[model samples]
Structure formats: C-alpha cells, structure tokens
Target chain A: MSTLVLPDQQVRVENTTVRHVRPTRRLGASLRKTLYRSGAIIGFLLVWELVPQFVLEPASRVFLPPLHEVLQQLWKMIISGDLGTHIVASLGRSAIGFILAVIIGVPVGLVVAWFAKVGDFLNPLLEVFRNTAALALLPVFTLLLGIGELSKVSIVLYAAFFPVLLNTILGARSVDPLLIRAGKTLGLNNFEIFSKVVLPASVPIIFTGIRMAGTSAVLVLIAAEMIGAKAGLGYLITNSQASFLIPKMYAAILTVAVLGFVVNAALVALEQHFSRWARA
Target chain B: MSTIEIKNLTKKFLRSGANESTAVTAIESLDLRIEDGEFFTLVGPSGCGKSTLLDILAGLSTPSHGEVLVDGEPISGPSLERSVVFQQYALFPWLTAAANVLVGLESQARHGQGPNKADRRARAHEYLRLVGLEGVEDKYPHELSGGMRQRVAIARALAHEPKVLLMDEPFAALDAQTREQLQDLLLDIWKRTRTTIVFITHGIEEAVYLGQKVAVMSAKPGKITEIVDIELQDRQAVDDIRSTRQFGEYRHYLWTLLHRHGRQGEEATIDKTLITSGASA
Candidate 1:
C-alpha cells in the first residue's frame, strides 16, 4: 500500500509542468525580448545617421543636418560646461516639484478613499482641475508666483500631481476585501491593516503613477523653460533659433530629448525594483 | 470553556438601488457554541451563509441582531486572538514570504512583547519552518507556486499564535493532492497547538475529514440543519481517516442533507421558469 502511494505521488509530481517547465521558457522569452528591442533601436539610429546625406539637396540640408554635425555641437556644449549647468538646474526644479506632488497627492488620495462622503465632495473639484492642462495654468502661475523659478517649478508640480493622486486612490480602493478580513482576524489594528496590507498591496500601481509623474515633470520643465528662462536647454534652443544657429538649436533639442529619456529610464528602473512582488 | 458563543444571531444586507428594497436575510435567529481546542467546520451549499457566519465570528461584519461572545467577551471588531486564513492566499504581494510573516508578528508585538526586528525575523523563520517552507523565505509571492503562496499565508496566520484559527475555504483553489497535503498539515498543527478552529467549506467530505464537529447549514436565509460529532477510535491522519468506514458514513449523511438543498434549488428554478413562460404566453 505504501509502494502504491509512492508511485502515485511521483506521477502527480510529474504532471505539474508549471513546477519545472515554464520557468526555463520564461528565461528564453525575456532574452528574445531584449535582443528584439536593441535591434530596433540600432536599426533606427543607422537609418537616422545615413538618410539625410543620400536623400536631399545642399541648400535644403538645413531641414536635416548630418549626424556628425549634431554630435560636434553636442561635444562643444559639453566642453564649454554650459550644457551640464543647464541640465542640472532644470533637473533640480523638476525633481523638487515631482517629490512635493507625491508628498501632497498620496495622503490626499488616501483620505479621499477612506471617507466616501469626502470623496464625493472632492471628486468633482479634482476632476475639473485634472482636466485643466498644466500648460493652460502657466499664465495664472506666472501672474501669481512671478516669472521666476517658483512659477516654473509650480507648473511641473501641477503637471505631476493628478496621476499620482488618481492612481493612489484607485490602488487603495481596489484592495481585496478578503485580505482586509484576514488582516482583521489576525488582530491587526486599523493602522496596522492600512500600513501592512493596504499600503504594500497598492505599491505597484502607485509606483506606476510615480513613473508617469516623473516623465510628466521632465516634459513640463522643458515647456516652462521655453516660455521664459535665461539659461537651461529650452533657453538655449529658443536663443539659438533667434540667432539662426541651426546646429546649436538642434543640439539644445537633442539635450532635452536625452534628458527626458534618461529620467524616464531611471523611473522605469525604480518601478521595477519596487514592484518585484507584482511579477507573479 | 467554550471558544465562541453565539446567541440569537440575525444578519441582513440592504440592497443599494432605486427601489429602497427590503433587506435580504443572511443568517437568522441562530445559536451555536464552539468548544475550546476543537477543529470545527461549517459546511453548506453556496448562499447558505457559512462564510457570513465566519465573518461575524472574525468580527469583520456586525450582525444585524444578536451577539457573538469570544471566551465570554463580545467581539466588537477584529482581534489578534482570532487569526483568519482566506481562500485567496492573501499574502502581501510586495513582501517576501519571511517579510509577510514578520508583518503579522510585528502587529502582534505591538500589544504584547514588542519584539525587536531581529526577534521578529527569527520568529517568522520558526513559523515558516513549521509550515515546511524552510529555505524559500526570501521568495516573493510571484516567485512561488500557488501551493507555496498558500503555505506562506498559513505561516503568516500562525506566526501570531492566535488562540482561535478561522479559515474560510483556504484550500479551495488548490489541486486535489495539494489540498490533501494542506489538510494533513492543518491537522498536525491543530493537534500540536490545540487551538480552537472554525473552518468553513462547501465540500462535504472535507468538512467531515477535518472537523470534530461538522455544522451543516441550509440554503438561503441560512440556518444550521444539524451538528454531527465525529466519533473515531483514534485521532488519525487525513489519508488514514479517509480509509475508515466511519468517515464514509459521515460523508454519506452530509451528502443527503446537501441533496435535499439541491432539490429545493431545482424546484425554485422550475417555478421561476414556469412563471416567466406563463406571463409570456
């Protein structure tokens, strides 16, 4: 009888392919994905580098400059150290604004979700503000805070606030009732349940919101600088364009694009780090 | 001493809609006393309110009428003394298995011994080992299999060393083999700790296999139909108990009660069909 049970258990173990087979397949699939993404990026750059030289006239070349000329301008800016200072200033404002938005938005979202009557009262107001674009509020902010660093940072704050607020509310409200019940039964107090169960469960969605907010902050920073600034990539682009220095203008635009890309990539890395539990 | 005492308990759920509909009764005018240190199960068909009754005992929901007393004190809300394991393996998805267990221990320590971080982690390790998940403590919920996740949930619940363990269909999502293994593990834990347990399940065989007292409930506006006490010669493992003739008798008896409820459901369906067809004609 014991021998009978042994073979039956062995067969049962053999039948569960999830316990063994799928993990190996998942590794192969991720490798393929990395290769595919890198291949597409390399292909795009190659096309970008070669296309203008072969396809257009000399006078018309102003529309699409050669990759080497853009790189040369980029090199000059780096050597002069103007690019680094501008990048740092813009990054500082954006980071400060984004962090402030998160600090304010997360608690407001929690309160809204916790009290239904409060949510009902505030939701309409939130919706009205969220729909009103951050760029649209630029004039209002400039008038109130002046056309200084405060006004610029305020615009980024407005841009980043909504996604974080909305996503945190969504994440908090959608927690599993069963998990709450489990928490209650385990003798966890209201605070403990909120901290241990609700907060941790909401993390992945909240991190997604944070990543979106980070990207939006970078975007708003560029727009803010473009409107009125003496230094920064946006100032460089507008000033160069006025003087008819097309290569310098393109270099400024390139710097903005690269800054946005790097900030977004860092956010993605942070989200992945925090949301490892959500992978399952 | 009785672990839990319920007297004249009634609960109703209000329908939230345009008509201001009358409340739907869940459990009405009920009374039960679960003995200390016994593995008790409530078994019924869906809509029989077994889960609702468990919720009341766990203090997740307030009864519309009557009262529940745990060890002679009325249950106002959830307490650490009565730990619950849910069907959906409610392990914190953001934490590793060890961290999840540590969260439970930390909550317990808030009122009790206030264990430091190192002590809490050590205690979490002990409970994890008890559930036979020794080496996989660092793994997140997504990294582990379903069975492993459930084991982590069990470990988290047990880490607090609650006096009463409440489980609501904790093994319903698992395969037959995993369910059996978990059932055996549950029995071993219960035998060792002698904690009063209130388990709810729809499976008649499972209720009979695990519970010392099986409380069978009727469908809708649920009521306890009968409470049968299992009288076995020896306290045996689940596999050994299943092979016994007494287990078969208890299983058949529960099936008969459930069969009667099934017939009532069919009759209700037929009545609805006839009324709709007649109106259409």
Candidate 2:
C-alpha cells in the first residue's frame, strides 16, 4: 500500500492558541510598563523632596523635617547599629509568627477542604474568629500569654492565619473536577489524588494567601510592638515621636514601608518559581 | 471470548430540581460484546448516554440494573485493565508530559509488580516516543497544542498497558486536520498494540473509519439500533477510503438510521424545556 500524506486542512492553529505576543520593541513596551508603575512613586518622592525642602522647612522647622534630614537620621542610626537592631527584631518577629501561621494554617486548610463534613462543622466558628480583628484580640492575647514576645507573636499569628487558611481552603476546594476525574480514571485512591493532583494545583492559590498574610503579619506585629517594646521598628517610630525626634520617626516609618514592599516582592518570586508550570 | 461484555446494561439519572424531581433514563437494556483486540466504536446523538455507557464499561459509573464484564469478571470500579480518555484532554496542568504518563503507570494496580522508578521513566519516554512526542517530554500541558495534549493523554493511557481502552470523543476538540491526523495515529497504534478499544464519537465518519464494527445508537433512552461491520479492502490505506462508494454507503446507512431515531429525542427535549419554561412563566 502506498503511503498517502494527509492534506493539511487550512488549519489556523494559531486561532486557538494563546500566546504572549513578542513585541517588536520589547524594551519599549517593558520600559513603558515600568514607567507607568513607578510614575506615582517618582511624583510622590519629587513632591516630598521639593515641597519639604523648599517650602515646609522655612515655614515650620520642628513640625515637618526635610526628606534629606530624615535620610541623614536614617544613615546616622544605621552607622550606630540601632537601626540594624530594630530591623532584625521586627523581621525576626514577623518571620517566626508567619512561619507558625503557615505551619498551622496549611494542614488545617487542607483537612477542611478534603473533608467536607469537617469544613461544614467549622464554618460558623471560623467565620466568627475571622470577623474579629486581631488587633482587638491583642489585649486578650497579652493577658493570656503575657506582655512579651509571646503576646506580640500571638497577635501576629492571629493576623496571618486567616488569609492563608481561607486562601488554601478556596484553592483546595476549587481544584478542577476534570483533573480529579483523570486521577480516578488512572485508578488513584482519594489520598493519592489529593496528594498528587489537588495539593499541587492549590500551591499557587496558597502562595497568594501566604503573600496576603505576610502583609498583615508585619502590620500587626508593628502595632503590637508599639504597645510595649524597646527593640523593634515600631518601638523606634513611637519612641522617636515621643522624644520629639521627627526625622527618626520618619526614617523608621519609611523603613517599615520598604520592608513590607520587600516581603511582598519575595513572596511573588516564590510563587512564580512554584507555579512555573501554570504559565507559558 | 470477548474482552468486554455488556449484559442488559441500564443507567438512570435522577435530576432533582428545586420543587420536583424527574428520572432521566440515560440507557435502557443495552447489550454489547467487544471481542479481544478488536476496535469497536459507538456512534449516537448528543445526550444518547453513549458516554454513560462507556463510563459504566470503565466502571466509573455503575449500571442501575445490569453489569459490565471484562475478561469474564464483573467490573466493580475503575481498574488498571480499563483506562479512559476523556473528551477534554485531561492532562494534569502541573505535570510535564513524561511525568503525566509516569503518573498513570505508577497509579496502576500492577505498579507493585511493575518496573522500578527509572524503568517506569524509560517506559513513559518510550510511549511518548510512540506518540511522536519525543523532544517535548519536559513541556507542560499549557505549552503544548490541543492535539499534542491529547497525544499525551493517549500516551498516558497506553503507558499503563490497559487491556481495554475507552475513549470518550477524545479528538472532538481538535481541528479537522489534527483530528484526521490523530485518527490515523490511533489506527496505527491500535494495529500495533491490538488493544481492545471502545471509542465513542458522534461523528459517523470517525466511527466508521476507526472501528471494525460501528454500533449505531438511539437516544432519549439509549439503545443500539444497528451494528454495521465495515469491511474495507485496504484498512491500512484509509487516506482515500472516504472517497470510495462503499464508505459513502456505510455513512449514508448510519446517517439514515440516526436521522430517523435522533430527531425524536431532540424534539422531546425541546418540548419538555418549553413546557417547563411556560409553567415557570
């Protein structure tokens, strides 16, 4: 029998294809996107530098320090190692609390998602807890765990837990039924399907939760530290403000903002690495 | 002895609405026997319960009153001996093509007696090669074409070495050219492996082309209307077979049978929906 080459029908396979268009001017497109994003930061910084230096300083010296003065104070604190100590203390607390939340939240979320009955039973209780602010619970935690590292960490854990828990539950529950069916057709047991398919699929969404929780963890930790702490970034800000050191207060606040930004960026990188398969 | 035996198989579905419940009879008293190593196809209209029947055969869905026996034993649940290829190429998006195939092998009942990890990896590679996907093993599902993803699904099914392969409109989503290409590829694989295949499709040409015997089914309560034996002179050279008079006659025969029975089910559906909507209004 003679082999016949199949005639290719007008197959516009590209019509069904979803591809990121390679811009003819790749640098231009990316640079434009970057500029659009950083436009607000640049405009804000320019206003901060110009208005505070040129206008505010001459009008009121003690009230609003120039951006340069704040930067200078930040430099001085860095040289004296005080700023480094506060940075370490703040990061350490957030890290410990966030890690604990992840450790507690992930398995609990997976269990609730995997077992519908357990989830249904816990739904009301979780809703109640999730609704109550972690900051509102700070006093109770302080009384229960004492006004120390334990109390501060507890508050931070409370803040961090709900985001991760909720996201993980959503992710696990939303796993594509097609994948579950495929797993069944492959003769995989329920546990095998959960481990091999559901867990892997939920990783991206779990990362999203982790990122959100990390932001809240830092915010709550700083607030908790401000209550009674001598060695954290929050302490630096409140203490400087009470002592009437405007520049130092500004410096501490700026550092905290930068730290939050860095933490979020790191989480995004981790998510990208884990979910490499999800993107083309 | 047949590799698969469907004895008086019936499946009914209960569709419960807000206020009322109705029993939708999907299949009623369907009997089919697929010989070992034979390629059999089931063709029917949409909602004909052809898929329900296939699911029952795969043991993913239980028959309401009867049983599906594979190799002389009644199937209780999904087994390694019978694997399914869903209409949507249900390749795990998280896994690479090779990993997807390996997963099937690892999940099979014979995994305990099967080759070690390295050997299993090699077998996966071999099957991917068999499907003409040699260099794309590391590519994720999103990175591959629709046809390529379906090929990976096929490779995954074949890697487990199932005695009977059940495909549910596997190539229905592909473009025409790719669909024809895959049809040829499947025929080639079936010829080489001689795995007893039960393929389900609404396409009469596809059913006739792929199967030794094509079973035409009717809907509303699905039942086999006819089983036509396709006796082509040169099955290997099927590229120009559709142009032949014999192929057209078979197509015309199946089309007429379907045209007669398929319309009643659809009209009933339209009338029922209209009545329901009128009642609600």
Candidate 3:
C-alpha cells in the first residue's frame, strides 16, 4: 500500500507542477501570436512595395502603378481640395443612411420581437426583402428617383437597413428569459422591461449590427456613385478611371478604403465606450 | 401585512409538435399561504416546478388554473409589489451594479410615487450598502465575482422596495462557502428589512437554515408535500443555529423528504434518457 501511494503522490505532485507552469507557457503562446501577426503584415507590405520596384517595367506599370505613384497621387489629391469634397460627400451619405437605419430599424425590431404574432407575420416578409440585394434595386431607384444624390443616399439606406433591422430583431428576441424574469420580479412593466432590461442587454449585438450596416452603407454608396454620380469618392474614381488616370483612380480607391477603415474604427471606439460594462 | 395566497395553482406548458403532444403539467393543485414578513422557502428536487410556482407568483408566468393574491389582490402581471432574484445572476450585464439598481428605482419612480433622480440614486446606494456592495457600485457584473454579482442582483431587486421578494435558488451557482456567506447576508437583510421573502431552493440544509417555514414540494405536476415550521428560540446567527438539536432535526426531516423526491427525479430522468436514446437508436 505504501509503495503504491508513493507513485500516486508523485503523480499528484507532477500534476500540480504542470498546472503551475501552464500560465508562463500561455504568456509565451501570446508572444508568439503577436510575433506571427506583425511578421505577416510586414512581409506583405514589403512584397507589395518590392513587386512594383523590381518585377514590372515602366510601360506595364500603367496597369499596376507602383505604390509610390499611388501615394504621390494621394498626396496631390489631399493638397488640392477635390479629395476633401468627395470624401465629405461619401461620409455624409453613410452617416445619414446609418442614422436612418437605426432610427427606423431599432423600434421596428423591438415592436416586432415583443409582439410574437407580428413577428410571425412579418418575419417572412423581412427575410424576402433582406435577401433582395440593394444593388438589384439600383435600376428602379435611378428610374424613379433619378440619377441624383437622392438615388445614391437611398441606395445606401437600403443597403444599411436590413443588417440593422435583422440584428436588432435577433438581439431583442434573444434577450435572456432569466433577465426578463428578473425584470418582472423587480416589478417592471412590459415597456419598462423592454426599455430597461431588454434594450440595454441587446446593445452589444445591436452595435455589431450597426457597425456592419455602416460598412455596408459605405460599400453600397461607392457602387451607387460609380453607376452614376456627379460628386463623391466613387465618382472621382470612376471619372479618373474613364479618363485613363490610373494613379489618380488608384488614389481615389485608396481614399475610399481609408475612409471605410476610419468609419469602422470610429464605430468600434463608440461601441467600446458605450458598452464599457460588457466583458472585454 | 403583505401575505401571499397561492390558491390551486396549476400550470401546463403546451408541447409543440406534429402529433399534438400532450400538455406538460409543471405545477398542479399547489396551494400555499405565506404570512407577511415570513422567511418562507420552497424546497424540492429539480423539475418539481418550484420555479414555475414562483414565476406564477411573480406574475412572470400566468398559472393555467387558480390564482396568486398578494394581500388579497389578484396578481395580473408583474408589479412592483413583488420583486424577484433569479437563480442565475440576472444582473443587467450592460449596466454597472449601481446603474442596475438605479434602473429598478427609476422604474418604481415612474409608476409609483415618483422620486427625483437624486432620491433614486440615494435609494440605490442605500440598497447596495444593504447587500454589502457599497464600495463596488461602479463595477460591472462581469468584473465582479459570482457572489458579488448575485449581491448586485439582490440589491437591484430590493431597490424597488417591493412588499414581497421572490428568490429562485439565487445562490445555486455559488460554491458551498460562498453560498453560506450569502445565506447569512440574506438572513441579515431579511431581519433588517422584514421583507416577505418566498425563497425557492433544492438545498434542504439551506431551506432549513434560512426559512421560518420550509415547504417541501413533489415532482411533476407539483404539489406541497410537507411544511416544517422552524423555531429559533435565541435569535442566534445562522452558524450558531446550525449546531443546535432543533436544526439537526429540521435538517433530517427535510433531507428525508427531499431524498424521496430526488429518487423520483432520478427515475424520471432515467426514463427520459432511455426514451430519447431509443428514439435515436
């Protein structure tokens, strides 16, 4: 019995030691993650910069303009005031569209979720419309609203609306039954439960939807502008492309990418600030 | 005096399926009367529909048969008269501990005797202190320990100053040590506030320790099996009472009652598993 117990105790001691050593191993694992991520990004950038420098001739560079030329065109656009107007126009469209989506989508989502009968009736309708791509409606919008800012803005709204509405519905519907019970126990009415418990609990998911909608809004606006528009970043890119100014077209494209990135970053920051109570 | 009268409460959940499945009776013919300010507990095995009974009383779920009356008034829906602390720490994760409590107070103010924001905040702070979470008001639920989160849930429930408080295994998730600590805190709060509490738990020791009257319930289509009235002669602390002969007797009695229900639950679960496995196979 003593001999058997000695090996068992040794095994227990080894297990404890292994548990103690695990956290340091985790730290090393995290370090490896950071190293891998940075290495991949730096390697990609280096290859992108080097490919144009060494691999391509100057004549063929018209199709794939070097990073430097694109950067130079970008700088010129920034200095000149043409880029600013286009960027502002795109930003304004996305902002208005996203705001409209939230205003209409959130309340509608809440009402639909709260009333099961209404949700049952409307779900198929929403599913049908949501699946119908906003791009598909571009022709109709152009005919009805004309090829103006209204068509462009409305297109952005249509693109953004589905995500916000769908996410809000999902968020509202998925509120923890326990939380609702807890709300009821606290003597909260239906509306109080919705406003105080359900809405606040759904914020993180709803914000995710809003962020997705914001990105979609920008993407759709760009495509809409490219179809037919006098102003906006998409217009600048299409105009430059049509005129065969490859560098300037690339510059406009880069600006749109940067604008989308900034908007996403801003929304993420807002989500973090508002949902400070959520687990990181 | 805010007594609760639960009369012939029966709840049946409709099972949705192609076969038009039979209604699952959660609670059946359950009648209980909790005196105002009594520390009453409902103890049973899981699936005994103890929670369903509490839900009906809280007005979260309507009973298919009979009624729940608080001070002779029928419960229609959730009202501030009865507040509940759930088994799971249902502290709103999006709000800080204080803010969650504030939500309760704000709702109360909106419907009841309205108070200014300052007054509401003060009331929230007061309840937070009562739950021993005064310094951690700004902490989010995820940031707090399980014990602290449950305390915040309790604080939120109490902030509304409801006449009756319904608790459904609020300490079920806590470890034994933490559970005991919370149990004591609950007793202290109950003593100070004299809030009529109807606590639901499967823990016999816990039911025996805190309850002035422990009502044992039976499984599926649940009904009250037995009621044990606890007498604490010296008004001793929970720990002190645990060592007494009367406490041992009460514990033994509840344990025996709960054991019978536990065996029934085990048999039901085995049957269910076998049927499911059979279907799959």
Lowest summed lDDT across 10 adjacent residues in model 1 chain A is found at: A1-10
TM-score of candidate 3 versus the correct structure, residues matched by position: 0.85
Q: Indicate which candidate wins on DockQ.
A: 2
Is 2 or 3 the stronger prediction by lDDT?
2
Model 3: CA > 4 A from native: A1-42, B112-117, B232-245, B261-281
lDDT of 3: 0.81
Regions of model 1 farther than 4 Å from truth: A1-36, A39-47, B113-120, B235-240, B264-281
lDDT of 3 by residue, A66-129 (tens): 7788889899988998799999988898789879988998888888888999999999999999
lDDT of 1 by residue, A41-135 (tens): 87876776677788777787776687778879889989999889888888889999999999998898888887889999999999999899899
Interface RMSD of each: 5.8, 4.2, 13.3
- Name the 10 consecutive residues with the lowest summed lDDT in model 3 chain B: B267-276
Count of steric clashes across candidates, in order: 2, 0, 2
Best by TM-score: 2
Ranking by lDDT: 2, 1, 3
